[model samples]
Target chain A: MDGNGVSGAARHAAFAPLDDGGRAEVVARRLSEAIALGLLGDGEQLPSEAELAAQLNVATVTLREALSALRSDGLVQTRRGRGGGSFARSPADASLERLRRTLRELTVHELREIGDQHRAIAGTAALLAAERAASEDLRTLDTLVDQLAGAGEPGDRRRADGRFHIELAAAGQSSRLTRQEIALQAEIGELLWMPSGEAVPHPDAVAEHREILAAVRLGDGQRARVATERHIGRGIDQLIDFHLRLARA
Target chain B: MVSDVRAEEMSAAAREVGTALDEVFAWLAELAGRFAAMHASSVAEQNQLRAADLSQLRASIFPRLTGNPRLLAGTGVIVADDVLADQPHWLEWWQHAQGGTELEFLEVDHDPASVGFYDYESAAWFVVPRDTGDRVVVGPYVDYSGTDEYMLTLAHPVSHDARFLGVAAADIRADAFEALLLRAIGAVGQPAVLANEAGRVIASNTPSKIAGSLVHEAEFAGSPVRVVLNQDAEVRDCAGLPWRIAALRG
Candidate 1:
């Protein structure tokens, strides 16, 4: 599965190496993001080392180093013997204590800064997606939105939610923007939509996704941008509230 | 209600698995302590331990300890070392185990080349106790390197005086656990699952709902023990791990 959850075409484009020295780090980051987004499921067997290294376009040694780094991070496992190969380990739940610690470590200003960057990137992607998205792209976006709406678990919903945004970026027909969206989602995606004591209900986010999709489908660039901004803004507000609550507790 | 009976059966089955796991953990803790002592003495004596020491350890230990015949699929230990530069000894064990009985002991090198260009330090069984300083239960994951069967790992940290040695570990085949679970709750007519903290089903009575699929706790709201739930699922702690017994009633 290679754990990225995207179709083969999109994955190829997104993972194409941009530079050399940091290739393994980039590959590792991309895979880690995919794993965190639940695109790569727990216990899923990864592709063979040669195949995966070829897919990521790196030397076998580089891929090995990246895999080593991932192992240290507890995101992957290697077993030996007949059928033994590397497998994805289930990520540890972002413990409330860890969440609280993260919040304590960040100031409100920094959170707002991250939110602002997210809004700019997401807003721009939505605007472009509305302008350039084809009928098929729109259909894909709709399907992802539907998946989000029907998703019952927080983890499933979160992954679908992340995919919807990345798909929107892809619909914009900009591989660069899609890559940026992937990186952005990797950074704040899990924390922004982290499960809490029913603080930020998923239905509201799913409803916002529908609005964004509807505008994008109609090629309403302005409306798409507005919808995207509002959705991201609401998420930012909820995260701030969560941060404050955790800090106080 | 029939749901009550089903819940009881499910709990009983979960408890059985939990008890088996508890015994496994106790054995691991004792083994880990012995290894820790040996490792400390080796370090003190400046002994240039060869790969043979590890092979001897595995031979002495894995062949001697017998686990629950029905519940356990295999038992083995992995020590953290750089003894094998190019090929992992665990892969050798896996090859040997494949030729022998259904269950076999296995080990892996932390080095990537020996482990199919993969590293073991990233695994939960190795990382959790190293990070949390506690014994940990990991998986219902496919042991692609061992039996290629879905298995759960019980691991304890082998450390001495704050110096971490390696992990002492064992593998429990999921099919065995699933068989036991199905025997307990298969006739209940409701989907029952035992899932880890991540909501991945470890064992389930529903054929379609196989192990490793993500299941939410909300799916089990109708479960009798609802409020004591951890995360999103109705759960009762098993073996001090985050594993839980959850059921979805029709």
Candidate 2:
């Protein structure tokens, strides 16, 4: 929950000025990414348009345009008159039919490739994080792992899972790596970890995260890399099973 | 004292916009996941499937989804296949309309071997994701195929196992996006401009600073809202890509 340090690292790499044209799109895109990453909570009230525009160094007109785009996309809703400001809407669930369609598209091979890339980035990040992480960073990672373990819903668990990896990346102190981790999560994190019929068994994942954390705390890079890679490898297997079932269905 | 009040209002607007964007991306990610999933299945099931098969899948899947209603021109999907020749997917939604809506969904294909002018693979939307294997939102460029209008494409890569399938994407007309910008600024009560990362103005209340013009940094100095710009700028990242929102008062 206290992710100020991690979020700052993420924002450092995530936000950059637009060169020309598409200002609104850029504004809209950034906010959307933040929302997807769970950096912004559902139904969170936003700052005043004037204040936000100035903060972003964009024209108020441009900020508003971006907001309007979001509104059209059903991401934000506006109320009129007093207390009439835009608020974030909870994300819509992808229809089951759509999920089926999506499942049909993904293959076991691709899942493994995604898992492989995840292992490289996450393994390296964990190894580096172990070497560089402060006690505070370790504490945050522990808390996130705990959060994931306790999360009752798939969505909460998924977000916590994502934040744990991102925080690990931040601990490594590489904006590039942190950004890469964030992008990978944004791209395939949810789908790869999505829970089918019952909740995804979290005990193993929680234990794996703890093992990586323990190694990082002990400053054992080799142990951290091995643990992180194994953790991801296990996830990849679970996802493959999920996809296989979908294909067979 | 007046500047303080103005600053507060500007801050509130920025927060609102930020929150709104969060919602948009959340929705998009879900759609991308579904598309990627479906595309993956298609690739896995039929590795040797023709371009026509992909086209048929696109035609069936894209038209059914209820895209943004504010879209001036309707939305559709595109699948660029290197192996298959340029076989375009005609927009069935646009064709069967009752009213004389001045809209046309032209069929454009990206054929690597084509001698003609257009190359879809070269487009940023297609190339970026293909190279990175990440979802991409590209545009505000002239879409030669459908309506010859500036458009935004929300595209994701489709891969089966390790084999890359094709790009699954949706196009939203740029004018629709511009309209949204125009309305947002009109309500904010300030002379403002939205510029891309390259400093080209995308939208502006200042009529002189039209779209496509380089946004001079000095432009923020003379406006009533300049005090707002004096404060630290807020940076919003879009679609997990490098694109961002740097709002400046002018």
Candidate 3:
């Protein structure tokens, strides 16, 4: 189908206009976060200034100010000459301050709702994967579990964790599910792992992955679904705790 | 028997669809050949295809492509590594967004480490033709990183002087392409499905099994209803592509 409802909604959300009273800081933050989350894509040329400004529903001058801010933050680069345009550059670090502000603004209800959506997508994916995954899919899941275990850095760990879930959806053999999983990871993964400065990812993450894999390998669909939901449930609890702590600060 | 006539007519309809795809492939192959020829004759240092030189050809590509009934999302050639000295990875593609008036060049993440990197070489449309030296059509799947639309990609390999160069590929909107097939098979007046070798529905006249729905493998072999190019049958293939049409009992 050309523009299935969900896909069309995703596209619309991508270029949706800013809320009233949004400024250059708001624009820069949104673009940088998207770039950091890998939505904008590294080395991808952005739309022309006027087109982008119109799409974002911002004045061209405001957009230019935002673009300069992104440039200084190393999230974007502008080149001059023929075939030259602003390009995305995936920054290595996300702004914890911005993420903290975002989390603090959201109510506990919103946080739980996001977790519910995550569990719905992931739990169904794992259940179907248990029933339908090929032997090679099992192998790939096993390998991702190993990668998560071996990952030393928090960024590496976050990436490995996100990949495992995405691959889990892919193993279910539903492209629509796989895509939803990807978008969700970009939206929520970093936030879940945001408190990475002094903390290594919980070792239990790898163990939870193993448990999910074991269930999937044994074709226990219910067990797989429950395990995935449990994993996400724990993650959301921790995020809520972090949000509360931020509010107090 | 009535069953035999039904089977023959369905087969003919399948052939008609296959032949239409074949014509598209032939046109693509010729364009690839011309691009290869142009690259070979260039006097530039190392004979690399320069952007300035290729700009001339890009201007001509969109007009010729506009003639096709299929609403092409994009079409162009991907140059193999080292073929273009100026850029390491390049796809000289032009895309017209649905309902757009003019075609615009597509720019994608070429960096290997980027999450949105478009590795065309690994994609089926490019890989199948490069490996088999034959035309290949892939998808009815989403092109998430690039177009963000569901698409079917048809590609033909481009080779020069016995060395593989790259591929000339076209991305057609799956919805439009499916519409084309639905119109072509309208005369069958039965619930017919066009499916890939994996039993994944490419398109169907029925709403029950939409694109990406899986048809049971057993249906291909065990169904009494007529199937063109049934599993392991020596029946004429769908123009050398691994697809079949089945007219199920309504």
Model 3, residue A118: what's the lDDT?
Answer: 90
Q: Which stretches of candidate 3 lie over 4 Å from their true place?
A: A1-98, A121-150, A163-180, A195-228, B43-47, B68-70, B184-190, B221-240, B248-250
Model 1 misplacement above 4 A = A1-249, B1-7, B43-48, B64-74, B81-96, B99-115, B145-147, B187-189, B224-240
Ranked candidates (DockQ, high to low)? 3, 1, 2
**Highest DockQ model number:** 3
Give the alpha carbon lDDT tens digit for every residue of B1-250 in model 2. 6555545555554444344334343444444455456656555776543444434444443443333445534433345454333444221123212245343444444343552335556566667667777666554443433343455566556555565545555555555565666655554456666554444444555676655344555665333221121113222122323222233454
Model 1 lDDT on a 0 to 1 scale? 0.64
The alpha-carbon deviation from the true structure for residue A71 of candidate 2, after best TM-score superposition, in angstroms, is: 68
Q: After superposition, how far is residue A1 of candidate 1 from its true place, in Å?
A: 38
lDDT of 3 by residue, B28-81 (tens): 766787778878776334666765565766755777567663567788888777
Ranked by DockQ, the better of candidates 1 and 3 is 3
Candidate 2: Cα lDDT at A47: 64
Candidate 3 local lDDT, A162-221, one digit each (tens): 989988887776667888988988987877665332112357889999999999999899
Per residue, candidate 1 scores C-alpha lDDT tens digits across A34-134 of 45434455676777888878777788888888889889878889999988998766566755335445655777888898789878888988998787665
The candidates, ranked best first by lDDT, are: 3, 1, 2
C-alpha DockQ of every model: 0.02, 0.01, 0.09
lDDT agreement with native, every candidate: 0.64, 0.57, 0.71
TM-score of predicted structure 3, chain A: 0.60
lDDT of 1 at A30: 57
In order, what fnat does every candidate score? 0.00, 0.00, 0.06
Tens-place lDDT per residue, model 2, A1-249, is 122332443343223344455489778866654443434445766668887676667888998999998788666788889988877654555533344345447788887788889899999999878766655568879999999889866567777888898888877655557777877877666664443321234666788788899999998999999999888887777656545544443
